[model samples]
Target: MRTLNVSISDIEYNKFGLKGEQLTFTDFVDMVSKELTRQKLNKCLQLADKYSLSKITMEEITNEVKAVRQDAKNRN
Candidate 1:
């Protein structure tokens, strides 16, 4: 594995120390990535919920749009 040497603030170092020896940089990065993904997903869900679109599946949305386009073509 490649090693990276970057400077971190004293506060950041102390905060990481609180995680103890069991937590390696890889573990920390994995944990942070998961947390960031979760937060982004939650924000997307919140926006969808606000728009009353949370109840609809992605497939349903795709189908609905396709149906509308087909209907428009049929009218023309």
Candidate 2:
């Protein structure tokens, strides 16, 4: 979800069973994160296909939030 990386030099480069493949723990985590995102997106797409839902634009969402904040300010 966030672009954060860790470097632990004490661990051997090929500590993972993938010998000859120079992949670090951070690299492995990043690869898994990408795969998880892809799988989640695919699942959401499948669910969307099975159901009908209304979608709102980013601008519409932002405007609604702004309106709510303004109303709250007025109430106070």
Candidate 3:
């Protein structure tokens, strides 16, 4: 196992009670990584909603919809 030293904000460390505690650094990193991934997924969903493309599928349906939209725009 390798050792890593990190510095976190006082509020965050106090909120999680990680200051001068017995928790392993690996555990802290894992927790932060999971939260980051969750946040990223939420952002992706928000963007999809903004573009009105949330109900898309990978088969012929989504492809046909995209092609039609492009064709309509190109004609104008």
Q: How do the residues 1-76 of candidate 2 rate in per-residue lDDT, one tens digit apiece? A: 4544445443534443344435566778886687689889998887866764226567987999999999999999
Instruction: lDDT for model 3, please.
Output: 0.80
Residue by residue across 1-76, what tens digits does model 3's lDDT show?
Answer: 7766677788878766565744687788887888799889999999989997687777767789889999999999
Q: Name the regions of candidate 3 deviating beyond 4 angstroms.
A: 1-20, 60-76
In candidate 1, what are the lDDT values of residues 1-76, reduced to their tens digit?
6666666677866854545534568787986787689889999999999999889988999999999999999998
Q: What is the lDDT, from 0 to 100, of the residue 26 in candidate 3? A: 70
lDDT of 3 at 52: 71
Candidate 2 regions with alpha-carbon error over 4 angstroms: 1-20, 54-76
**Which 10 residues in a row give candidate 2 its minimum summed lDDT?**
12-21
Task: In model 3, state the lDDT of residue 70.
Answer: 100
N/CA/C clash count, model 2 = 0
Pick by TM-score: 2 or 3, better one: 3
**TM value for model 1:** 0.51
